[model samples]
Target: MAFGKWVKQCFESVVDPDKENEVAELTQLLQAGIKERKRSFVLAEVLQDRVYKQRHLDQARNGIYQRYLARAWADGRVQESELEILSWVSKCLDIPPQTLRAINLETARPKFAEALAKAMDDGIISDLEAAELTEIARAGGLSLPNFVEKFFHIEGEQFLRGIFAAAIADDHSAVDVLEQLVATAAKLGLSRKVVVEAIRPQAVQYIEHVLADAKEDDILTSQEESTIRQLIETFELPIAVQVYIDEELRELRLLTDIKNGKLPSIAAPPGVNLKAGELMHYHGDAVWQFLRLLKSGPDITEHPGVLAITDSRLIFRSLTRSGAFGFGTIVAHDSSRGVIEVQRQAKPVQRFICHDQSRIPAAIFLSALRMANQTLTSQDDKRRSRHIPRDIRQRVWQRYSGRCAECNAGEYLEFDHIVPVAKGGSNSDVNVQLLCRNCNLKKSDKI
Candidate 1:
């Protein structure tokens, strides 16, 4: 019944014949624990039952993934959440991201292949093929690289044109679409200037055309002014071109508000809780928009959002729609006090703007985290069922007031397992809450 005996016995039960290195480490730790009169440590727990440890973790990963797949299926295809988690889930499980992506591609490949075949039944991806093609692309889950070795155009010029036309045809929609394309191109290692240049010929013409569409009786209305404001911040234009645009906008009386940064208020519905449920400890003014260090891009790059420090987490919710421009929560490096780390994806942690860096809630965030479990392990490993019952999803949805448990906004909601289905959490209504896609990304079930 002694701790040392249990540790030795569990060590012997490990079936790996090629784990002499691990065995040596285990024995060393056990000996040191006994010599130091330390009864147990967190590392000692993993030796208790190797099978349970591995099996539980595997089931946790699989269960949550299955839940994602099922939901993705119900939504008619794979989703961004399903795609993004492939990296984090693999990291936590200590598997290669490429391997997880390969597995995903394997399972998703055939259904999409058949869809693609149907789309090409007419010999071309015409209007009859457009919907199918979109589904196929979503399901393929391949071809996009983390970095650009060379400029890649596998998506085809027509595909790009289709995207551009679909996104830009509407005058109001063009402003948002341009931002999105810029962001996406950035992921492909294209600078904003490069992206603007690629479309330079049309950029001016489209800007003028859209502006004309916005004018009413040759006078820009309030709606047109707002549109101009949204379009005005893109700095990729040449100084001279920007000057011309500014002069034109001024003539149309749309320059002042755009230049001064007049923006729509962030106030949500009256009863919606805009803050986290508990730990309203932070008393600082929630600056409407400040820049955070960009997660994985240029050093000068920053995401605009209000910095939030609350009971549950310290998160930077981006000002961009669906949190399209945010970074990760501030997490601790380990159990070491005062040694904290920012959990970011895509890129290594970089410095933020000086003003924003001064506002990081690292001290309080780390203080709270130190008191809790050092490892934010998922609960899915030991749950009774990974499948959440529909009734439970409905119940949890109502419990959260039909808003994202993370960010109380948006109506296009998805059910997220609080403990993550892969970690063995149930599909019971108590286990799930509705979150908009943006909040879901912010609150991914992965570590």
Candidate 2:
């Protein structure tokens, strides 16, 4: 057949209402590859052939039914009349109920999207709108929760998270508003798990900010405690967050106690003998290195070990080495780079470094060392001698402009020894400088 003749026949078959060959017309419609929307009406018309059913018509059946569903839902609603017509069409075409349901669901997705977009326009889905959403999903052959999980749950979760962030960012007292938002999210079919996960990050961030503010002075005052307790009651914070809070509070108390000269003591580890009066102030994993000047160059031999600091001595034990050194044998100590470096009289300078999770920070280690050394120095005598001569205090205070040398803070200022007196530093003008309490506490006894 000529191309023109075949094309002419195809048009006649489609236009004729009482066409003799319904199958041929339908075949031509499918073969011509016309867009589904344009050919769907004619396809539905021919599918009314009661005697022409075939397994080959299944694909065309699905397409035509999808078009029926899409048109019925075009106005974002499926009326009772449209539902009756759809049922008639499905029965005429012998489409399975499950297949019809699948087609409707696929067709209804866009309608759901449109409705959701409008409902979310103001960043809220009110109770009435939420009800409409449930009805839409159900009418479209989907459960509201399942549909949300498959399509809009992530977006819904993000929307709730944004509300949480904005609420907390605006003011901490917005807890009541946050509670309402959470309830609204729940009503919109978002799961409790999703809601909680959405709020967790923002809540944790707020808690951290509050903790930082409370510990700003290295002390948790009674008022700060009250505020923290209020937050806990307000949020009903999760155990993980509570654990972090407890750990931070414990560390703050420990630091405050250290600052007040109440050093913590630990029992000696196995195989390590303690002197009669020696008290263990600190113990942790450490890498001890002995410095050397070799023919090739300067070298260090590292002995990985456990190091203990005591009132009278430093003890180190390792698989390959073990030793103890009296405090009197120490020449100087420096912790400038997170490592404790000790210069010993007539012995190689040793470096103690730690890199584990429980590793001691250099500043804290120095604080412990200073507190430990106080046991050897008369605690009362050191306190009395800490008083600087008036002229020396005047010269040091003027040199730093009456501000902390370390942080430039002028409040709660105290005269600090650059080289601690226990380390043989005197109350000389050069050795004294003004440091705020916080910085001085952090500096401790490092020389």
Candidate 3:
């Protein structure tokens, strides 16, 4: 009946491996003692000192005590459960969930605790606040202490101030002001990681605000916003964020243009045929006019003599004796002048321009026209055409023995324009020479 005598009997019962019922009875007794005493340490020490099977008794004491605490926390009132969990947590590294809630509610630990207490006392934080904070902390991968410290350090005081100020002014969106505070911190060079760490404790609320703002502003498409968020996870700086935004914007523009029929939908190979997505290298007024006509629906019947065939730019030309369309180079004419004149090719050949076919597109063709007009206006001297014809390109390739001039690599040979198209060189024979794609791209406009 006495504590000492009862403990002695329990110790004996615990160590007797053959006495299964006695061992079970001893465990129950030990658990009852721990619950009644409400002291695990005392129970542990008593088992260690007085029990016959010291190790087994000690194990039973700790295990039963922990189970008791866990059950009580799970079943009892939240406050009582939290107190018990905290007590156990203080003695060990892993705190129970109830204890974590208690710690979150505590306004006494340090800076964060003090701030939280003030906010709660001022009615700044509602009942929902604790749950929000907990969720945020879990999402941010921050411990309770770390989450509190970072949140208070970053925006806690400012947020309280904003809330009080907003309440006084009768503004409903007090939360928006707090978000602006966080954005201001970001702009002021607060590391994204730091902001993320601080925000995780209030992740749900922060996310709601983000979604609302996105909807209100209509600043980013859903895809763009998702990409931004992903990039934010990887890169947490403003510059990196801006770079991604710019890239997304450009892609969006391209997609929109393609969708609206401003840009073609099909992919056309570069060189002769003008397809929607193809790159053209030629620059000339005639080519520009041709591209414009193609983009605008043309009445193929108007040009009865015009023929459609593969591998030729002269779709419409005067017919020959054969019923099949004859292939010939058709000269471009200036209708306004009522005269036949040599067609001026777009100058300063674009090394890598989008192609409709081998021909230039309307957009780039227009750019060349503007450049040419500007050039003519600026200079009083007679304009001399500077182009390299195909014959010259072949001759140059023959001169180089069909090998790279610099490296003598012979697998792929191409015609290289010595003067870049941007600089007003033409695709004529005199200005062009043969080089491999590698050498051509490498040489670029250097010469």
Candidate 4:
């Protein structure tokens, strides 16, 4: 037979006739009775002792007696209706109505009436149901308030339904709904912990909905999806954490190129100036080192050159190698001070070298050197009294469009020594100039 049929048969066979009759009556009352009416009837039945007495019945009665007694004592009078109800219950139950009245003379007041009213409103419970519950409570030696609290605690279907409603209304994002549910439970004076525990499955369902929506919407790219899935599998992180990891990874990749050799290198453009006789420098030691290290290993052959410059600070591109770039600066001077400084001053401020030597034509370097010399000559003119070379000055004048090369404010300009006479430049036209006073001062011998 089916499970329900089997259960019904077992119950019918095991339960005594009196108990079965009581159950049948309760079922009928529960099926038809309104909340408050049923609760009143249940309370009447409890007082009448329709249910069997247990060792804990006296303890349970003590609480009910105290509550009613306190109210009677406070009013300095007992309502005749309440007294009649108490009397009827006492006579039927074989308890002393006089004893209850005596207690009321000292203390009595309802403590959980409001809670009982609410429980009645929720369909999971009713007055007749509470009467049945009271039987169990009395048998367990629990007061009415304590019994009601425990009953609500163990039955959380209503709480779960509320959580489900909130979750559905909020696009099925469980965290948001759960937070509201927690606050609501607290405000309603429900057991927050028990409610939360009961609603956990519903919350999980909502979380699944959120994740499903995200996936269906393609909010995460293929790579992001893969990464998130991996994180979820490996770490078993919550959905929120998985989303966070995906976002973080995406941001990092946006700021960097991860594919090997994919990043372009900085190149010295044609005709740019370089200081002649000054040793030229190239910064690519990190790339080279990475290449060597990766080549030495068995896993890979090449790595991408990851290098960039920001605010004059050189940033090396990340590589799968073991070491960072080395910096070396070269200087050229008269034999007396011919020295080069080789030290790691952080990293290159800018990357100007190509990894593929074949791509760097010789003409590019030559042009760069010429540009560098022009820059140096311009500097020399400012620091000495000797005139700049006519050829150099002509170029300078042309560069400044025949205006004063120094201030760019005066026409009919002169060539002034960028280096002073004491610094040993010639006094000839090569070292002299026709200049406006502002240009002369502004272009004082200082490079």
Strongest candidate by TM-score = 2
lDDT of 2 by residue, 100-177 (tens): 887777777777887887787776678888887886787677777778888887777777777776666565454555
- Rank candidates by lDDT, best first: 2, 1, 3, 4
Counting clashing residue pairs in each candidate, in order, gives 9, 0, 33, 40
- Residue-wise lDDT of candidate 1 within 95-174, one digit each (tens)? 44565565666565566555544543432345435544444454545442321222234332233334555455443365
Worst 10 residues of 1 by lDDT: 331-340
Candidate 4 colliding pairs, count: 40
Better of 3 and 4 by lDDT: 3
Q: For candidate 4, what is the TM-score?
A: 0.25
Query: What TM-score would each prediction reach against the true structure?
Result: 0.24, 0.46, 0.29, 0.25
Clashes by residue pair, model 2: none
CA lDDT for candidate 4: 0.39
Off by over 4 Å in 1: 1-143, 146-158, 182-201, 214-216, 254-447
- Displacement of residue 16 (Cα, Å) in model 4 is 17
**Clashing residue pairs in candidate 1 (N, C-alpha, C atoms within 3 angstroms):** 60-422, 64-421, 64-422, 380-423, 380-424, 381-423, 388-427, 389-427, 392-429
lDDT comparing candidate 1 with the true structure = 0.45
Instruction: Give per-residue CA lDDT, model 4, range 1-447, as digits (tens).
Output: 999999986785576455544544543443243233533444455334345433234434444444444454344334556555545444433446565544432232232333344543542344455554343333233444455465555444465566455545444434445555555444334555655666655443333323322322213345444533542443344676556545534433422321211223344223222333332322333242211224456331333453332112233444453232212121211100011111233422222234423112112222233243444443234323332443554344344443444455432233454444646656554454434434564454222
- So what's the TM-score on candidate 1? 0.24
Q: lDDT for every model?
A: 0.45, 0.67, 0.40, 0.39
Error of 3 at 97 (Å): 17
lDDT score of residue 181 within candidate 2: 70
Better of 1 and 3 by TM-score: 3
